[model samples]
Target: MSDTTRDGLADRFEENRPRLRALAYRTLGSAAEADDAVQETWLRLDRAGAGEVDNLPAWLTTVCGRICLDMLRSRTTRREQPLSEINDPPSAVESVLADEVEAALLIVLGTLAPAERLAFVLHDLFAVSFDEIAVVVGRTPQASRQLASRARRRVRAAAPAATEPRGRAVVDAFLSASRGGDLGALLELLDPDVVLRATGEAARLDAQGERRGAEVVARYFAGKAQAAVPALVDGAWGFAVFIGGELRVAVAMEIKNGQILGLTAASSPAALAGLTVTPL
Candidate 1:
C-alpha cells in the first residue's frame, strides 16, 4: 500500500480505538489490558493493508475481540504480580476508564468464563449482534447467544460479592482447614475466582504479589498459617500471623456469598504498625 493509503488507514484505526478499547475493557475487566489489545489490533491492521479490509469498523471489532479472548484464555490461575502491586500514577486512559467502569461490575465480569464474557460484552453491551460475536468466540450464533444469556444472569446474581463482604463462617472453616493442612477442606472454602495478594515478609510463603483460582490459592495456604490465629484487621474479618508472640503478618479475607473472593496479607513492619488487631 502507498503512504497515503497507509496514513488514511491509520486515521480510521485511531477513530475506532475508543470503541475497540471499550469492548476490550468490558471483556477483560482491566483498562491496561484493554489498551494493549487495541494496540495489537492496530498492529494487525497495519500489516494487512487497507485494501484487504472492506468494512473497517467491523473488521477492527472482530480482530480486537479475538485478541481479548486469547488473552483471557492464555492467562494462568496464578499471576506473579497484579497491577495493583505496582505504585504508579494512572495514565490518562486508565483515569478515564476508572469512571467508565464500575468496580463491582469489573469484579463480577472478571469471574466469568472467556467465551461468556466476550459474547456478553459484544452483544449485550456493544450491540455487536450474535453473528459477529460468534465469529470472535468461534461458536455458532445460537451458541454465542446462549453464552451471553448465561453471562448476563451471572452478572446480575454475582453483584453482591462485589458490593458487600460476607462469609465469616466460611473464613472460620478456611482457617481451621489451613491449620490442619487439609487441602480438600481449604479448597472447599475458596471461590473459583479467588485471588491472594501478599506483601512484605508474607511474599516469602507464596510467590510474591498475587495468586488466583481456588486450587492455586488453596495450595498456597494448605498446611500453612499454622502460626496464624483468627482476628480482625482494621475492623474487617481476617487473621494475624504470630510467630513467638510477635505479630508478623496482618491478613484479611474479602468474602462473598459464602466463599472467599480475595485475600490480602501485609507482613512489613510499617504496614503491620497501622492495623488494628483484635484477637477472637
Candidate 2:
C-alpha cells in the first residue's frame, strides 16, 4: 500500500479502536484476548483493501466480530488441551464488579455462542441498534434482537444479589488480618474448602503454582507475611501484598462473608517492573 493508504488506515484505526475494544471485551470477557482480537483485526485490514471502504468503522467491526466468533468456537477445543492455559485475571472493571456476581456467571458467559454474546453486548451494553448488530453478527435485525433478548434473560435469571457495603467491610477486615500476620484471625475469616487460583504472569511467580483450600492459602500467606513487609495494592481498601523491598509484588483479593475466597499475587519480576507501590 502507498504511504497515503497506510496513513488513512491508521487514522481509521485510531478513531474506532476504543469501540472495537469495548465490543471485544464485552463479548469475550477477557481484556488480553480483546486486545489480541483488535490487533488481529487491524492486521487483516492492513492486508485487505480497507482504505477503499466507505464505512471503515463498520468494516472493522464486521472483521473483528468474525474474528471473535472464530475464537469463541475454538475456545472449547483449546481449553481441552491448551499448550499454555492461562485463566483470565480480573481486569479493573471485573474487580469492581466481582462481588456483585458469582463464579457461575463467568462460566455461563463462557458457554454462550459468539453471535449471542455479540448481539447482547452491542444492544444491551453498548446500546447499538439491532440493525448495526445484525451487520456485525451476520444475522437479521430481528434475529439479532432475539439473540440479545435470550442472552439478557439468562443473565437476569442467574444474576446474584448486588454486593452490599457490609460485604466490602468483611473483605477489608480479611486484608487487615492477613497483613498483620494473624493466622488465627485469617483462619476464622476463611471457609474450610476455599479455593484460590491465580493467572497471567502471576501464576508462575507463585511458589506453589496455585493453592487451594482455606488452610493451604492461610499457611502460604502466613509464611509470606512472617518474612516480608506488607504494602497496600491498587489503593483499594481490601488490596494488600508483600514486597521484598527490592521487588514489588501486587496482590489482589476477593472476599466473601469475611473470608478470603480468592487471592491473586503478581510476583514475577517482569510483572512487577512497571508497577508503582504505595505504603500500607
Candidate 3:
C-alpha cells in the first residue's frame, strides 16, 4: 500500500475502532481479549486492503466476531472461569447499554454455547440482522434466530422481574389478549418493531413467514392463539399448540423490557422432535 493509501486505511480503521472494540468486548466479556481481537481485526484489514473489504465497519464486526468465537471456544476447552468485568473504562456502547446489559448478564452469556453467545450478542444487542449475523456464525437465518432465541430464554430465566412483568407472564398475557381478539391489548404487549417468524404448520395457519411492526403483528394475532397454551418449550417459559392432545407446534419468544421483541413459531415435526416441549 502507498503512503497515502495506508494513511487513509489507518484513518478509516481508527474511526471504526470504538465500535469494533465494543463488539469484541461484549462478545468476549473480557477487556484484554477484546483488545486482542480488535488488534487482530485491524491487522487482517491491513493485509486485505480497502478493495477487499467493501464495507469497513461490517467487515471489522464480522472478523472480530469470528476472532471472539474462536477465543471463547478455546477458553471453554481449557475449562476457564466465566467472564468477569475487567475494570476497563466503559466504551461508548457499554455506556449506552449499561442499564440494558448488566454484569450478571455477562456471566450468564459466558455460560451459553459460543455460537449462541455470538448470535445473541450480535443480533439482540447490536440489532445486526439475522442475515448478517448468519454470515458471521455460519448458520442459516432461521437457525441463527433459533440460536439467539434459545440464548435469550436463558438470559430471561436468569433475570429478576421485580420491576415489571416478563417471561411466562408476558407470553400468557399475549395469548389471552390474542384469544380475546383484543387489538388494543395485543398492541400494548408487542414492541413497535416486534418481529414474528413462523415455520411449517404455524406459517400456513398464520401466513406469517416473517412479519414486523406492532400494528401488523397485533392484527395477525387478533382472534389467534386459540389452541396455543402456556407451556415450556425447550425448557423455557414459552407456549405450545396441540391438536387433539398431540404436540403440533412450539412458540419460542424473545421478550425484553416487558415487551415481545420477537416471536418464532416452530411447527415442523422434525424441529419439534428436536425440541423438548411440555405443557404448563
- lDDT of all predictions: 0.75, 0.62, 0.77
- TM-score of candidate 2 versus the correct structure, residues matched by position: 0.50
For candidate 2, which ten residues in a row score worst on lDDT? Answer: 78-87
The TM-scores of all predictions, comma-separated, are 0.54, 0.50, 0.54
Please list the Cα RMSD from the true structure of every candidate, rounded to 1 decimal place: 15.1, 15.9, 13.9
Sorted on lDDT, highest at the top, how do the candidates line up? 3, 1, 2
Taking the tens digit of each residue's C-alpha lDDT, what string does model 2 give over 106-141? Answer: 434554567887787677666778888887777899
Clashes of each: 0, 0, 0
Runs in model 1 deviating more than 4 A are 78-101, 165-280
Write out the backbone clash pairs for model 2: none
Put down candidate 3 lDDT per residue, 110-135, tens digits, no spaces.
66889998998888778888998899
State which candidate has the highest lDDT: 3
- Name the regions of candidate 2 deviating beyond 4 angstroms: 77-108, 161-280
Ranking by TM-score: 3, 1, 2
